[model samples]
Target: MTFLQALWHYPFLQIVMLAGLASAVASGVVGPLVVSRRLAFMAGGIAHSVLGGLGIAHWLGAPPLLGALLAAVASALLIAFASLRIRENEDMLIGALWAVGMAVGIIALAQAPGYSVNLMSYLLGSLLMATRDQVMLMLGLNALMLGLLWLSYRPLAATLFDPEFAALRGVPTGLLYACFLIVVALAVVVLVHTVGLVMVMALVTLPAATARLGTARLPAMMLAACGAALLAVSVGLATAYAGDLPAGATIVLCAALLYLAGLLIRHLMERRRRRSA
Candidate 1:
């Protein structure tokens, strides 16, 4: 009842709830495509790579969010170019970018004079610190991603699942791939605040991973992931509030538990099917 009252009474809490749900939707939709295309590591690289931009921003006394956006987009484009076109030691290149970016961020932080802001907040995240402006920004970004995905669903699905066939069918695979990377970069920016840079990849990947265990089709997988993400975010938010826990870590842990449960259920179902056969 106290929880219900707090939600019912507070406007800021409502905004936080809205933000959490919106973030989940963004992750749910993007995660499967990422996992399907085996770009999970690349996404992780992008996530960590943003820290370099943030550190640079702090050192220069500029807005870190803007810096993060530019840095992440740059990293995403570079990886997209190397992996898609060069096709030589692609993973190694991304790995190098990841390490270098993180190192740059740490160095920037260490050198910054009289830095008072807690880096933990950027790394672990706290939903209670969410502002109305940030929530609105996430809502806008989510709408943009969904709209773009809807407009290009056919070609995008083709590019995701079967790029060779898509190209053969006149899908302009190269252009679509670049556009997809742009969308991914934007999504990462929106998600970083929700789960922080360190744990953001888990939020992006876990729900979709659990959904993948049940469905093979892209559309079905996305819907299942949305459901899983919503439940995790809602439960985690409530649990964190009651226990005075870290919101970002709590949400991610909840999602991880769901993935494990999904894996267990999938294993059992497979065994049952084999026995019936």
Candidate 2:
């Protein structure tokens, strides 16, 4: 049977596809900001810090995604506030926050009972376990994020390029930063189920990085990033089904390979241009 037939036959596969598409769109949309702002390390910090939230939720028998969202948003806010105050060497502040957040999470998890069994699943994702409800939730969150971005596009662009100038123009840069943080936090929470915390940063970064090579404009870059992410997820799912590989690892590896391929293609094109010149 064809892939479409398989998808139609297996409701679970359909759920996976929907979740993957939602994740791809969210990652693509938020990723460029992270890359453009040199916030890759900051994003990593936020991802690790979310562990604390996860631990707390697990200990209380609540949803891990809720905990992660709370923790991540707090961390993002703290980082944004610190960046405003520090004025210099913000990376150091972000790194410190990252360590503190992860340490807290580890300690909390250690105190919680019977939490180790699914620890790896949270760290590395388990796509097979994703439910239809979760997929629907992810889609809703992605739509909300896209809407927020659409509403704040101009200020966001200004803030990303020059926060001081944006503020001079009465753009409320701090509030905008906070809003972006919230969106990132939500995206991370939605993605935790399918991408996992350990590998989440890659899914958010690689597609944007690969897409950056194809375009200079923000809208074009976002489009390329979304395309790259979709390609990675689709191909990764196919490979996992065909070869019976671990789904999360397969997806990440597929994205990494695509990034490498894009780099190679860019290099070849550059060489060809040089030869013609």
Candidate 3:
């Protein structure tokens, strides 16, 4: 059957498509900031740190997304603050925070009875299990994130390139940075349900990285990244359904392959340029 036919026949497939699209949108929107700020490692740290929130949610009988969002924002603030103090060893600080967060999460999970199953789902991701409510929540989060990015694009762009210059021009660089962290935290929350904490960075980085190879302009890169993310998620979801593989892993692997293809194209473009010159 055709892709559309399969999608039409299966409610679960429809849920998966919606989930993947929302995930792609969130990832694409936040990815450029992560890339430009040289905060990929920090982003990874925040992603892993979300386990602490998941554990707390399980213990309190609250929504895991809320807990994760709270924990992620706290973690982002901590990291941002620590970077100011430990500029030379920022990675070390982030790594330390990441370890501490995961340890706390695991301990909390152990303390809560019957949480092992829920923890496992958070670890591996279960897009197939997303309910209509969860899908709507994802869509809402994406809308908020994308809207914030659009409204703050100019200052954000200035800050990303040179905070000092942006500040000289009257942009509140510090405030913008703080806002960026909040946005990243929200993106992490949206991503954790679909890609989980472990593989979440793959979704955020791979598409942006692929797009970067083809374009130097930030606007073009963002658009390319969004397109690449959508393509990756759609193709990956389809492959997972056909091959019985894990959805999150399939999506990440597909993105990695696309990144490789982009690299090859970039290399060819460069070689052609050199030959013509």
Number of the predicted model whose lDDT against the real structure is largest: 1
lDDT of 1 by residue, 1-277 (tens): 5656888999888888888998889888999899888888878888888888988888888877777778888987887788678875767977887898889987887787764667887778757788888888788888888887888888988887899999899898877887787778777877888888888789889999999999989899999999999999998889888998988899999999999999999899999999999
The lowest-lDDT stretch of 10 consecutive residues in candidate 3 is 79-88
Off-target runs (Cα >4 Å) in candidate 3 are 1-3, 84-89
How well does candidate 1 match the true structure, expressed as C-alpha RMSD?
Answer: 2.0
Candidate 3 per-residue lDDT over residues 30-73, each given as its tens digit: 88778867778878888889998888887788877778888989
lDDT score of residue 104 within candidate 1: 91
Regions of candidate 2 where Cα sits further than 4 Å from its true position: 1-4, 85-89, 113-116
On a 0 to 1 TM-score scale, where does candidate 2 land against the true structure?
0.92
Preferred candidate (TM-score higher): 1 or 3: 3
TM-score-based ranking, best first? Answer: 3, 2, 1
Query: TM-scores of the models, in the given order?
Result: 0.91, 0.92, 0.92
After superposition, candidate 1 runs with Cα above 4 Å error:
113-115, 270-277
**lDDT of the candidates, in the order given:** 0.85, 0.83, 0.83
lDDT per residue for candidate 2 within 125-172, as digits (tens), equals 888778877787788888888998999998988988898989988998
| Candidate 2, residue 208: lDDT | 93
